[model samples]
Target: MDGAIWASAYGCQGKAVASSAFGRPSGELQARADSPTPAGIRQRSGAEMIMGQGAVPIIVGGEVVGACGVGGGPSEDAEACAAG
Candidate 1:
């Protein structure tokens, strides 16, 4: 769940990075789109695999203390588990 841990550290949802990576296959994901390349899918999977998923930051007093990663079924299912 490295992706999930990274998510907490970055203070962003796991899906955000994945989506960005998919939406943009060339250059920085934050850059131009409408010209997605095969590299985009690779980047997305790599980031997700390396960063982790189905995880949520454990915050206390407005500070992140830890994170929880859940994986069993689909990413959505995992995310739902983490959310609860």
Candidate 2:
């Protein structure tokens, strides 16, 4: 990919440090942290995880494989792009 594209995508630019780590979509995680469900509260995960919709975790065989982050558009659009 070209530098321009890389820079535009959140994680593609060697920026989404949690690329090596694995977990739910950052938005969900962030939401839980911000205002957890009635049954339970959550602790802060880390800085690498962000509070947005562009990140999509790549899972295989029930295991986290990698991730994709598309950041040049709205939340739904970017999320769809990454999922594809």
Top-lDDT candidate index: 2
- Model 2, residue 50: C-alpha shift (Å): 1.3
Which segments of candidate 1 are over 4 A away from where they belong?
1-49
Q: Please report how far candidate 2 places residue 7 from its true position, in Å.
A: 5.0
Which ten-residue region of model 1 has the weakest summed lDDT? Answer: 24-33
Instruction: Please estimate how well model 2 matches the true structure, expressed as its whole-model Cα lDDT.
Output: 0.51
What's the TM for model 1?
Answer: 0.40
> Which residues of candidate 2, in runs, are more than 4 Å off?
1-7, 11-22, 33-46
Q: What is the C-alpha RMSD of each candidate to the true structure, in Å?
A: 10.4, 5.4
Q: Write the per-residue lDDT of candidate 1 for residues 1-84, one digit (tens) a residue.
A: 343443343423433443333432111332333235544554656644223345555566866555555554455566566668
**Residue lDDT tens for model 2, 17-80:** 3332535554444444444441132223433444466667778898887777666556566666
